[model samples]
Target: MRAASKKRGIEVTSISRPIKPSDFHDFDLILAMDRQNYEDILNSFERWRRKEPLPDSAPNKVKLMCSYCKHHTESEVPDPYYGGPQGFEKVSSMMY
Candidate 1:
């Protein structure tokens, strides 16, 4: 992930495991890479909603990665785990 971001001249900061809302309190928004990833994060957040001692009106902070697109991207980058170079090329093209 560092390599990919750097290759595009994109800077990134990392987050530790997000087990608590306070862990992400300083972050404005969370971005999930895809549907499955979004679902996983949503599930974790749902549990937090029930168990964490959060404020009644804390700001909402989660979103889809593709929603941040506008510079060039218009949709989620499909996972390339089963595909080859052509698939990767597609994702790269979209981001650029």
Candidate 2:
């Protein structure tokens, strides 16, 4: 991922972390890479909301990352970890 981004002149500095309920309050948008992730985020939010109320609009902030892709027909970004270098390249190309 770093190599791909660096090739495009983008600095890949961010670390990967698991999503948390607090993210609902911290970020304007939460993009999930796939349907499972999207559901997981909503489920997490629902569980968190039961403990403390969040704005009704919080769920709306979560979205499928590919929904924003104008050129790709893929509904989800496939996990590239098992796809090897070519798979990583394909997913990286979809980023923009």
Candidate 3:
């Protein structure tokens, strides 16, 4: 996929991985790709906070990626897993 995209002047790569607690402490901003991801990241932070209480400012660290957009058409980024190529293209355009 990366090679195919690169051929077209679009560079896309996958760095998919499970979100970790240290990610919260490590990065100032943690943007979730979608709602489920946002919820999961919040839940992960809750668990991490319980184990090793973070600063009261911790909750402010996470946010939905779409929130950064100038025109907020969607509250969350839609998952394209079950859809066709157009779905993926839409998300790519939204993210871009």
* Tens digit per residue, CA lDDT, model 2, 7-64: 7788888988998778888999999999999999999999999999787889999999
lDDT values, one for every candidate:
0.63, 0.89, 0.75
Largest TM-score belongs to which candidate?
A: 2
Candidate 1: count of backbone clashes, pairs at least 3 residues apart or interchain: 0
TM-score of 1: 0.59
Using Cα atoms with residue i matched to residue i, what is each candidate's TM-score against the true structure?
Answer: 0.59, 0.92, 0.79
Error of 2 at 71 (Å): 2.4
- Candidate 2: lDDT of 57? 89
Window of ten residues with lowest summed lDDT in model 3: 1-10
Q: What is the lDDT, from 0 to 100, of the residue 30 in candidate 3?
A: 86
In candidate 3, stretches whose alpha carbon ends up further than 4 angstroms from where it belongs are: 1-8
**What are the per-residue Cα lDDT tens digits for candidate 1 across 1-96?**
444555677655875464456745656677776777777766776677687675444335667778877666455668754456666555654565
Per-residue lDDT over 1-90 for candidate 3, one digit per residue giving the tens place of the 0 to 100 score: 344345457887666788787777788998997888988888888888888867667669888899997555887877766556666766
What's the TM for model 2?
0.92
lDDT of the structure predicted as candidate 3: 0.75
Angstrom error of the Cα, residue 2, model 2: value is 0.7
